[model samples]
Target chain A: MKMIIQPRDERTQPARIIAGYPQTPLRSPKEPLVKRAPTLSELSGPLEVAKRVKLLGGDIAGQGEKQAIGQLIHLRVRVLDEDGAPVGGAVVEMWQANAAGRYIHPNDDDHAPPDPNFYGAARVVTDESGVFELRTVKPGAYPVPTRDGWWRPPHVHFSVFGRVWLARLVTQMYFPGEPLNAQDRILNAVPDAAARDSLVARYIPPGVEPYNALVFEHQIVLRGRAATPAQP
Target chain B: MMIPTGEATIGPFFPPRYVDAGANDLTVFEGRKAKGEAIEIHGRVMQEDGTALENLIVEIWQADAGGIFRHPADPRHAQADPNFLGWGRAATDAQGNYRFKTIRPGAQEGRAPHINFMVMFSGLMRILKTTMFFEDGKDPVLMAVPAARRSLLIAKGNYEFNIRLRGENETPFFDD
Candidate 1:
C-alpha cells in the first residue's frame, strides 16, 4: 500500500505547555512527534542518605540530671538554592540523641545510659524561605562496630524530602571538636575537608538556669555532581 | 488554582527549605540545554471496574541526573541547594495520559527509594496519591542509575514512564 508521510514541520510541534506538571513532553525523533516531556538529570542537595524509619528504635531521652528538662539540642538550619534563595515545599526529617546523649531506638543498644521517654524523631516541612527547626538533646557518644574496632561519638541523624521515596535521606550531625570525631571511620571517609567539618556542630551552653543544655547551629548542603568518568 | 480532589491523603509537612524558599519562574529557559526530552507518560487511572478516568492532576518529583534535588534537603549530605525543588505537576489527558519532563532523582542514602507521586481528579472524592519507582535493571550496575531514570525507559528510543492510579496493582498511599 502507498503511504503518505506528514510534513517535517507538522510532525515537530513542541509539547503543549501544561499549566502545572513541569516535567512532561518526552522528546522523540520520528514523525507525528507530539512534543515529549523532557527527561531531567538527577537532582541533588546537601544531605542524601537513606535509613529505615522503622529500624530506628532505641530510647535516649528522659535521662541525665533533672536539669535536663530544657537540655535540648536546638538546631537552626536554613535551606537555600544555587541562587541562595530559600526553597519551599521541601521536607526534613531528623533523629537525634536525647539530653543524656543517647538514641531512642532499641537497635541503638548504647548501654552508656538510657532515656526512656526520648525517641528523638521529628518531621518538618519548609516554609516560603526554606527554614526548619528541631528541638532535641545533644547526642551522647555511643560505641558502634567498625572495621578497626568499636568507637563512639556524639551525633544525630537527619533526612530530607524531595518527594516520597526520592526525598528520604539518612545522615548524622556530629558535634564539633568532639574527641571521638577523629576516630570515626565514616566521618573520615568524606573527601571534602570543609564539607566534612560542616557536618559537625559546635555547642553553646544554654543561657537559662544551670546552663547545662547545648545549642548547635548547623548548615547542610545538597548538590548533584557526577563523579568523573573512569579512564579506559 | 486547581484544587486537588480524590481520596488520596497527603502529609502536613514540607521541608523547611521548601517552606522558606522563594518562588521560581519556570518560563525563563530559552535554549536546547534548557530543553528537556519529551516522552509519553501514558497510563490509566481506573475504578474497581478498571474504567479509565480523565482530568486528573498527576504530580511528580525527582532529582537531576547528578542526583541532587533542587531543594535544600537533598541527601548530598553536604552541599545544599537553596532552590531546586525537583517537583512538578500535570493533569491527565482524555485517555488518562499524563506527562512530565523532570530530572531523574538521585538515590540518596543508598536504598534508592522511589519518589512519591500523587493524583487528584474531578468526580472522585479525595486525592489519590502513591509512590513511583525508577525501573532499575536486574543487574546492579544498571540499577545504579538515579531513581528517576530507573523509573523511566527508552521505549522505541523515547524516554517514557506510564503512571497507574490507585486501585489494584498500584501502591496504596502517598506518605508511606
Candidate 2:
C-alpha cells in the first residue's frame, strides 16, 4: 500500500528565491522542484513534538518585574487544514523580535535595545477546536541589514507541524494595515492577492477583549490532505 | 476553494535557546535509553556561496530499531518501542554543523532504513525537505530519484551527509 500527498499549488507559494533577499540568489536553486509520489516516509512524522520541547503556554510577553515595552496584544491564532476542518494536536512553534526590534540572538546586532523581560520564543499545541491563543507584546518592525533601505514590518515567524509531514508549513504572519506589508518582497511573492491577505492578521481594537492589549486574530491554513487512503 | 497560507523567510533571528542541548539526542525516552545500534549523523549546511549556513534547524523523524513508528499513521504504531524516542531536532553550530545521535532505524513498510529530514533557516523562504539513508540499504523511493542524484541521499563514509542549498553539488530535495 502507498500513501500520497497533495502536491503544492505553486501560485500560493513565494518564489523560492527572492531578489532583494541577498541570500536567496545564492541558496535557492534555479532548477524546477522535483516531483514524486510520497511513501510512508512522507506520510508519517514526529509524534508528541511538545514532549521534547517545553510548552510555555500562550504568553510570551514579559517576565516578573519588568515588562516588554510594546503595545501588549492578545493574538489568537487558529491552525486548520485547508479542508476547513480543525487540526487538533498540531504544534505551533513561534519566535519574534522584542518590542525594540532586537532579538536576544547574538547575530542581531541591531541598535534596538533588548528587553530583559522578554524571552521571545514559545510553542503550543492546538486545542480540539484547532485554535491556540497567545498573549504577548506586539513585535516591532526592524530594518534589513542590507545597504538597501528595506525594513520588515512587525511579524511573527511560525513553524507548524500538522498531523503528517506533508502538512508541515513554515511562514510569517504580518499585522494588518502595516504599510510594510504591501512592500514586503516575501509577502508579495505570492502571486495570489487572497493568499497574501491570508498571511495578515486581523486587528481588533482594545477594550473589546478583557485584557488591555490590543487583539489580533489570525488563521493559518496548512496544506490539505494528510493521506489519501492507502491503495492496495 | 481551499487556499493554503503562503511561505515566508525564516529570517536571521532564531532564538539562541530554540531547544536545549539535549535536542541533538533521540536515543532517550522517559530517561531510558533506546534499543539497537546507536549511530550519529553529522553534516554541515552550506549556502550557495559555499559558506556554512549557521543557526539552521535540522529535524529528523524515523522508525525505531524494530522498524516501528509510534505515529498513528503507521499501521505498526502499537508495536513501536516504548523506550525509543523516534524524533530529534538540532540547530547548526557557528560552523554550520549539526549532529544527531540515534540508532539506525529498521526498515519500515518494506522500505529502507532512513530518517525523514527537514531543514528550516532564515535564508530560504520555505522548508527544504529530504531523506537520509544508510549506504547499504536501497529504498524504492530513493531509487525513484534520478540515478545521478541518488548518491546525494546516501550518507557516505563516516556517516557524513553534508547538505548544499544550491549549485552542482546540491542535494536532491523533494516537493510535497
Candidate 3:
C-alpha cells in the first residue's frame, strides 16, 4: 500500500543565521501567528570593564602579540529561559582582565604593562541549542575604588542581547570561595541572596588542559512577553 | 496644561549611515557593528490616575561620534558605529509601555538642543519626535537632543527618567 506524506513548511523549519540556528513557528497568516521575539540588549558586564592600554591616538598601529594565551580559557555558556529551554541566537560578548589583572584601555591610570598581543575581547553568537563556547584565559581580580577600600574578586562580566518583549539581564561571573566577593560593593548590590549566588561560577578542576583553569557556566532567562499595543 | 508649541532642535550627533551592511560582523575600529550591552527598560505609561493607554509608537534616533547624521546632509568625516544604528521603533504594550536599547550620546559643544526623543501616541498621527530639557540644568541651546536623552537614561550604570507623558507633567519640547 502507498502512503501520502505531508509537505514541510520552510519558515517554520529551523533557520540558520550567523548568530545561530533560530527555530520559529511556520510564519503564515493562518498559523496562529506566533510573533518573533524582540531583540534584547546585550549582556555587558565582564565585557565593559575599563582597561588601561595606550590610546591609539589617531595613528596606524601594527597588530602585536596579545594572542599569547592561545585561547586556553574555556567559557561554555548555556542560554535558557525561566523553564530551562535552550534559547538560540543569543549574542554574547566577553572581555576580562588578562591573566595578569590588566585591561587594554586608553584612560587606565594603573600604569601596569598591557599585553600588546591581547585585545582581551571576543564576541560569539550562540548555537542552535543555546550553547556558546569561548576559549580564553582566566582573568585575575582587579581593584576598583570603594568607600572603605578597593575590592574586586577575580570574575568575568557578562552582557546579554535580549528581546524587547523580554527583560534584559547583565551580570558578572565569580569563582566560588573568593575572599573579596563578600566585600565587593558591586556583587553586594544584586539585592537577592540567591540571585547573587547564581552569579558565581562553580569550579571544575582537572582535564581540559595541563594548566587547567576554572570553568564557569552561566544560564540566562528571557522574561515578560510583549503586550499587544492598544488602538488609539 | 501647556501643549509644547516651541520648536525642538535635535542633533549634531546623528549617526552616519554605514557603507557596509553586515549584521554579524561588528568591528568598531573598522566602523562595523560593535557589541552593545543587553539591558531591559520596562514600565507603564499612565495618565494622572495611572490608567494605562496603548497604541503609542516610540521612535529614537541619535548621533554617532563627531556629531554627524546617518547619510549626513554633508560628508567628509569618520564613519558611524555600525552597531550603534541611532534609530529604533517600539510600540507601547497593552498598558502603554515602550522600551529601547540606545546608548547615551556623549556631549558636543555649540550644538542645537538637548538629546531628547520624539514620542508619539494618542491623537498624534505622525511620530512626534521631541527634544526635552532637564528641569533647570543645562542650556538646551548648548546641548544635543541625543545627548539630552542620554542624560535621563538608565543602565547598569546611569539614572533613568520615568515620563508621565501627559498634562504639565510631560517633558519640555524644543523648536525644531
lDDT of 3: 0.40
Worst 10 residues of 3 chain A by lDDT: A20-29
TM-score of each candidate structure, all chains considered together: 0.41, 0.94, 0.43
Q: What is the full ranking by lDDT, best candidate first?
A: 2, 1, 3
The predicted structure with the larger TM-score, 2 or 3, is 2
Off by over 4 Å in 3: A1-66, A69-72, A146-148, A208-214, A225-232, B1-176
TM-score leader: 2
Q: What residue runs in model 1 are displaced by over 4 Å at the alpha carbon?
A: A1-38, A41-70, A99-101, A146-148, A163-169, A204-213, A224-232, B1-176
**Of the true interface contacts, what fraction does each candidate have?**
0.04, 0.68, 0.00
The lDDT of each candidate is 0.41, 0.81, 0.40
Task: Evaluate residue A153 in candidate 3 and report its C-alpha lDDT on the 0 to 100 scale.
Answer: 72
Which tens-of-lDDT digit does each residue in A1-232 have in candidate 1?
A: 0111111221111122221222121111111212211122222221221211112212223444532333455666665432344545555666655555555444455455655555556666666667765555666665543324535477665545432232223345678778898876445544445556766775555684324435566655432112322244
Give lDDT tens digits, candidate 3, residues A14-76: 121111111101110111111211111101101111121111211111124435443355567
Candidate number of the best DockQ: 2
